[model samples]
Target: MTTAVFAGVDVEVNEEGFLVNSDEWTADVAEAIAADSGVGPLTELHWKVITFCREDAAREGTAPGLRRISKLSGVGMKDLYALFPKGPGKLAAMVSGLPKPQSCI
Candidate 1:
């Protein structure tokens, strides 16, 4: 794993690490995730979804399902998949240093 310090936080991540600081994720970290994910700038919609996922995971102790993410962000499955082509969006969110999601293992 590789580590980067952001906002006085030590963020450790893997190659596809996008959600490493889910607990204290910021726009800069989100940008890092987008860049690492090979995506362009994250839209407000993307930030909304990621933020919701992080908050929900922190509160509920598990990564929110696609249905819940969609409900919270008003983003559809297709769009979510397009944004997060990888299987686990939650992982990406975690790698971004957002926080520890609820259902993370």
Candidate 2:
């Protein structure tokens, strides 16, 4: 485990930089993590995905997958790629302060 200073808050992270403890997450931490993940700034649309992912993680113990984010969160695949870059599933989960889902790979 490693510690990352997100939004000035030190939190535990795994080798891939995803949070080790989801309970330590906060909106500010998510913003900082998003910026670090190359999202730069969180927009309304970005917030939509983040909110959905966090909520889903809380309810389901994991962030929704890419297709779920696209279909349920209404972000679409292209827009999710544009917003999160790289892989939307991993990036969105990292930004949402949850561990990366197994399906990301």
Best by TM-score: 2
Off by over 4 Å in 2: none
lDDT, candidate 2, at 16: 96
Provide the clashing-pair count of each candidate structure. Answer: 25, 0
**Local lDDT at 11 for model 1:** 69
Worst 10 residues of 2 by lDDT: 96-105
Model 1, stretches more than 4 Å misplaced?
5-10, 14-21, 87-92, 95-105
True-structure lDDT of candidate 2 = 0.87
Residue 68 in candidate 1, Cα distance off native in Å: 2.7
TM-score of each: 0.64, 0.92
Cα lDDT tens digits for candidate 1, 1-105: 688664455666655554443555677766765665566677776676767776776787766766667666677878887777764455445533544334423
Q: lDDT of each prediction vs. the true structure?
A: 0.61, 0.87
> On a 0 to 1 TM-score scale, where does candidate 2 land against the true structure?
0.92
